[model samples]
Target: MNEAIALMKRHRSIRRYKSEAIPLEHVRLAVEAGQAASTSSAIQSYCVIHVTDGLKRKKLAELTGPQEQVRRAGAFFVVCGDTRRHRLLCAREGRAYEARMEAFLLAVIDATLFAQNMALALESQGYGVCYIGGLRSQLFEVERVLTPPEGVYPLFGMCAGVADESPMERPRLGAEAVLFENKYPDDESMLGMIEAYDERYARYIERREGAGRGWSGSMTKKFAEARRVDVGEYYRSKGADFS
Candidate 1:
């Protein structure tokens, strides 16, 4: 495989970061590379917020699952699914538009593309990166801090910096379990593949965490819990009109 393929294969989320700071110029270039990411219909319905304040980072860490990575990373960014610019353009041109589910999905797709591109770009620059999904865990606090408008929502955030350590890549399910041909195989066939995968994942987790709960056990526990997140409602309240 080529360099890009090799790099992607070795991808790992890094939470432990060194204290060294990344130059602002490089940060801007990485963001520009993110901007180059494929946008849904070229709408570019996304935005990024770079936060450098120490106190604010601490506050974000507290609100976002108290993740130390947010506070400790050399550079932090919040990627937002935005429709504000589109709304403004529509209003200026006397065009009719409503923030529906489709619009929301497009915004999310655009933002996700940008974030992934940014991650790759930063990694290519020799920076370790991690995406903080915890931003969604506490919506109100994140909204308060970001102060986004009605046509914008914080999708996720990223932390990038020099790495303190190198970690092993996590294992993934085999092609048989995930990648189906034109037609999906029978349930039993898939289950058989997953059974094999479970054994591999169990060993992986055991080696990594010293406790091997395996795939089914870990996923069962994760899904068994009531994760009552009002994501759709929150977005609706913030100008994501599905009607």
Candidate 2:
């Protein structure tokens, strides 16, 4: 494999980290790399907040599953989807900023792409990184803490620092299950692939976590109930339209 592909394959979601601080210059370079990521219609609808306040970080950690990484990591960032600039542009022309689901989707996709690029850049610098999706646990509290305008939505948090642990790479489904020739495979074929994956996943979990759980069992229980049902309402409050 090429150097880039090898680097990509070595990705691990690092949680524990050493206390060494990442230089501010490195952080800026990472952001620059993130800005280089592709955007839809050239609408750079994203903003990143570097949270350095000790008190704010403590509160955010509490809100987001008390994930201590937020408070203790060498650096922490909150990636947001922003449409405020577009709204102001419409106002400049005395036109209404009509909210559409498509626009909202574009902002979300753009922000996600930017974040992944930023994470990859940080990882390339030898800093371990972890994405904190638990930030969605309390979107309202996050808004109160960040105090972003109506058009900016905090999507997730990220922590980057020197690695303190080396974790085994998690197993994923094989190409035969995920890739297809022309048409989607039948349910029977998909189930067979998933069953095979479950066996491997169970073995991995037993080795790493001493748990016998498999992907299907965990996913089935997780989706058995509607989760984060209020996320849509939170977006609506930010003037995002679902219709």
Candidate 3:
């Protein structure tokens, strides 16, 4: 495999981090990498808030289910989908800013791509990063804390630092399962592939001796219980039509 492909394949989310501070140059490079990602219409509808305040980080950690990784990481960033900039531009040009569902979706995708680029850059620089999906747990509170102006919404948080320990590679779906041909395939074959994947994942977890829970069982339990509730209201408040 090529060097870049090898790096991409080996990429993993790192939670535990050493106490050392990340270099300033590396941080700048990571931000540059984020900016270098492709954007829709050259609008650059995204913003990255480089968070350094300890108190704010702790508060964000609390909002994100008190995840220790958020607090322990040397740096934290809140990536946002920012339509406010274009909205302002539209106002200056005497045009209406269409802040619709499709627009928001595009902005969210742009922000995610930027975040992934930054993650890859950090990894290349020997820094570890873990995305905080739980940042959406208390979305409204997070927005309030981050204080992004109207038309900007938080997509996710990323924590980065020198890793204290390595993590085991997580399993991914086989190419046969995910990569379909020109058209959609039959469900029976897909279901069979999924079953095989679940068994493979279960065996891998068992070998690690860590939780030992199968993928199907764990996923079923997670969805069946359904603890997440605040996200809906939060999205609605942000003027997103969730209906």
Candidate 4:
């Protein structure tokens, strides 16, 4: 395989890390890589806050369901979609600042692209990274941690450091399963693909014996016992428009 393909295939989320600090230069490179991602209308509506304070890290750990790896990582960064900058610019220019869903979507897309670029750059530099989606579990608390103003939303958190050990890469569904041509495929074919994927995933777990639960069984149990709540209220409080 080509080097890019090999690097993409070898990428895995690393949660555990050794007790070491990343060099300042590497951190700068990773941030620069993130900034290099394409943005909508040249409005780079994203910001990254690097958190290295121990107390802040501990608070983040608590907010993110006590994820120990977050506290142990060499650096933690919060990627946010910020419309506040544009709003301020409009104010200075005597223009109305209308925050629309499209604007919010653009900001989110820009921020996510930046985060992915940063992840790839870090991986290329022999570092490991894990995206902490659990940051959304208590999104309001995260906003307070970052002290973001209105119109700025915390999209996700990333923890980066040198990996203490290598972990197996999880398998992805076959292209036939996910890639739909000109039109969407029928459910029968999709269902068959899902079953095959579940079997493959089950076999992987069986071999590792790490989390003996099979994919289908675990997914069923998760949704069956999960409770639905209005977490969007938190986002609304932060001036996000979910309407």
The per-candidate count of clashes, in order, stands at 0, 0, 0, 0
RMSD (Cα, Å) of model 1: 1.4
Error in Å for residue 181 of model 1 = 1.4
Q: What TM-score does each of the candidates earn?
A: 0.95, 0.98, 0.93, 0.92
Tens digits of per-residue lDDT for model 4, 138-209: 777776777888888887899999998788878778788878889888888888888888888887887777
Q: Give residue 177's lDDT in candidate 2 (0 to 100).
A: 95
**Which of candidates 2 and 4 is the stronger one according to lDDT?**
2
Local accuracy by lDDT, each model: 0.88, 0.92, 0.85, 0.84
**Residue 157: error of model 1 in Å?**
1.1
What would the per-residue lDDT of candidate 3 be over residues 120-144, giving only the tens digit for each residue?
Answer: 9999998899999889888878887
Candidates by lDDT, descending order: 2, 1, 3, 4
Could you say which candidate leads in lDDT? 2
Compared to the true structure, candidate 3 yields what TM-score? 0.93
lDDT score for candidate 4 against the true structure: 0.84
59-145, model 2: which lDDT tens digit per residue?
999999999988888999999999999999999999999979998999999999999999999999999999998889999889899
The local distance difference test score of model 2 is: 0.92
Query: Could you tell me the lDDT of residue 92 within candidate 1?
Result: 95
- Give the candidates in order of TM-score, highest first: 2, 1, 3, 4
Model 3 poorest 10 in a row by lDDT: 234-243
Which residue pairs of candidate 1 clash? none
